[model samples]
Target chain A: MTQPTARSGDRFLAAQPRGTGVQSANLADLLERVLDKGIVIAGDIRVNLLDIELLTIKIRLLIASVDRAREMGIDWWEHDPSLSSGKRGLALENRRLRERIGELEAGRTGRRTQSPDADYEDDETPPARPRRTRSTP
Target chain B: MTTPDLTWLYAVARDVEDGALDGLTGVADEPLRTLTVTGLALVVGSVPRSGFDERALQRRLADLQWLEAAVRAHHRVIAELARTGRTLPLRFATLYRDDRGAAAFLRGAGPRLRAALERVADRAEWGVKAYLAGAAPAPADIAAPADRPGTAYLLRRRAQRDALAQRFDEAMAAAREIHAALAALADRAAEHPLQSAEASGRAEPMLLNGAYLVDRERVADFGAAATELGRRFSGVRLELTGPWPPYSFADIGPEVPETVDPAGTGTAETAEADVEADVEAEAGFGADAGPDAATGAAPRIKPPEPRSPEQPAAAEGG
Candidate 1:
């Protein structure tokens, strides 16, 4: 597939109508490629890992603050089941099993340190607040 | 005494023609220059030491406005150089004491640098990110029979949860399929960590964040494949970006260690002495006179033929 002999640069600009110039490119994409990936030649000026980490934290905070100001509940990853790992799935299953075991133990002992009803109430209430807040925005 | 200006390194290339970099400017709007040593050209510019010294750089990096401007300026230079020829873009803040320091560093890194340049020659990096479509609608709640309202309500809730889990599973499966299809068409593929909705500024969840190094000739084929995948997988949106300089595929060798200051005192004099000593030790040993000396001309590695088997089916299906 031989293309026209025009320079690859011109071809790039033509191919991407959205434009690959700095103004068109998003900051997150630029940061991910520029900072996180590339040739790492250690120059005289030393930018340690701590500095990069701090910059990343600052960017995240900046982005989060903007989201907060807009009142957009953009933390869908936390609630998205596909994005959540199998480990989280196992943790939820484990919690359910533990609750069942506690119920069984309470029935056998005919006494309870804390009522299962109280535990259920705790679980139901806290989760409800976040869900409500998310839906409002 | 005035401190000498530092050299801000943007990229490394082979055989840039005279006047190719004319009128090109880099970070801080400094005019770009090339320091060619042992056949590699270090595309650089001069920035004041007062602003780019280690202490000042640390402060500037923390300032989001300064970093954004600098990063954009740095990328603009690389993008312009890439227009002329194959360019290996350096990380954002690579600054040398002067041209001599940069040349010495290049001499030491010549062979590996040559290998990296060869690998990316006539190839462009393209990004493919996939996102889930607008929020999955909630499963309709079933009306409870009059007699056993509580049991019916619980059953309906369980059904809704199951439906959501199933949708999530299908979305993930579609993402894996999309990545596999795109990876087959490119010369090399890398999967970057997914960006969160907040970072991406999109309402939908990101499913795949990938970078593919495609032969310049096959960029069209690769892009077509991505568009096909987008259509094949309904409810999942695929975004194709770039023709980027090979930022994702430039890792060819171990990195040379940066000079570390054990003492909290980061004095410029000590750092200068250390860099000069490093340059002399490496350059004095004739490190640049190795077998890879002929890298002044571009190395011609055979380009892989564009893969065709599964692509035809995808194109037809779409």
Candidate 2:
């Protein structure tokens, strides 16, 4: 355990818990590694008769965390939104919105609308901001 | 009472004390045992085949109660062993046909298993997540001039968009800086994808999900640095958890020779895994794959073993 230290000026010394059980493992912590690391001992329990395979339940297990999974290059969760931060969702949304705006701008150029608001829109002197392709930096 | 049960494997250890696991039990209150092969010790317990059969296993896995109980049991054993000595934990529900099969497998994998154990010796993993605190209530700006309503509206919209972008950049910058500081303290570190709002249950977005493998001796120092980072960036709330088994750093030992595609030609399969995380919502079987909910704990879709004729029909899990 790290003792709480005094902050000197702008430098804030981080506080540490007086007591922490480092040995304990939570469900998330344990599940993180079970699939992407270690020895996967494979065995099959088969029940068969008359030269035909009836049921073959193959048991293959490896323990690993997300980091361990990535070390082995098994990083499917990075692109998966449900299991990850919603950056992927945000990226998709931004892309779709940009496309829609592009389409709208293109259509506006093809036909002059008689709407009264058109003059006000034209007087708007600002150039459109360049589209930002990245949702998360 | 005939128990044509198989051995439910938990973990493999290298230097546990003699009888360190004495009096310990496993899932369903079954007796736990230790089997040693080539100086590597395997921790296992008997799980009746009646409940563990493929059909029954799938059904039980779908039940959160059953899954949680089993995982708790499995983790309890690994945690105890890890506390005592170096251990390599197995995925939930790793089972063998019998003790003889387990022994043979251990013997065959002896070299790789030993290497894996060595890699994790005296090392533990720590989790650090950084979240952006909800943006200061949008800096309540009621100072808009009533005379210029249209200009004010557009200006307000523009300001909101700019503020949003600026906040994101600040959060990302804070996350990167914190991760770098923590990484310096740790022997090795990894950045995991962030958890979603539903999973985290926090309105502020998660900016960083990082795991560090710190030496047991320097854990305190690492923790202190993490705490300092949290304090330094008041805008982002940093969460530090664990000194857990080296779960995120244990892939250095063994290579599944057959599936070892350095080229990562498994794009099709990974896409399938992506779809699996999507279907998890409708499947209701690990639907709450959020970390808070039992690690969103469920078995991942294992690619079909070449030799096995039967595979799980449905692929659902994180």
- lDDT string for model 1 (A20-134, tens) is 4533244457787777667776778986432232333234333223223134333432322332344354244334433443443355445553422333322322121111000
Model 1, C-alpha of B97: deviation from truth (Å): 1.2
All candidates' lDDT scores? 0.60, 0.52
**What TM-score would you give candidate 1 relative to the actual structure?**
0.64
Off by over 4 Å in 2: A1-41, A45-137, B1-3, B134-146, B252-318
What clash count goes with each model?
0, 11
- The residue-by-residue lDDT of candidate 2 on B1-318, one tens digit each, is 235888888888885687877877887688788887657788888888888876676556544334445655776677678777788877666777678767766654555566557666788767787766543436338568999987776666656656666666776788788878988887767665455332332335677767777777776677667666777776677666665565555442332322233676553223122221111111111121223233212322221212111223432211
In candidate 1, stretches whose alpha carbon ends up further than 4 angstroms from where it belongs are A1-14, A17-24, A49-137, B1-3, B134-150, B255-318
Q: What is the TM-score of chain A in candidate 1?
A: 0.27
The lowest-lDDT stretch of 10 consecutive residues in candidate 1 chain B is B277-286
Residue-level lDDT for A13 in candidate 2? 21
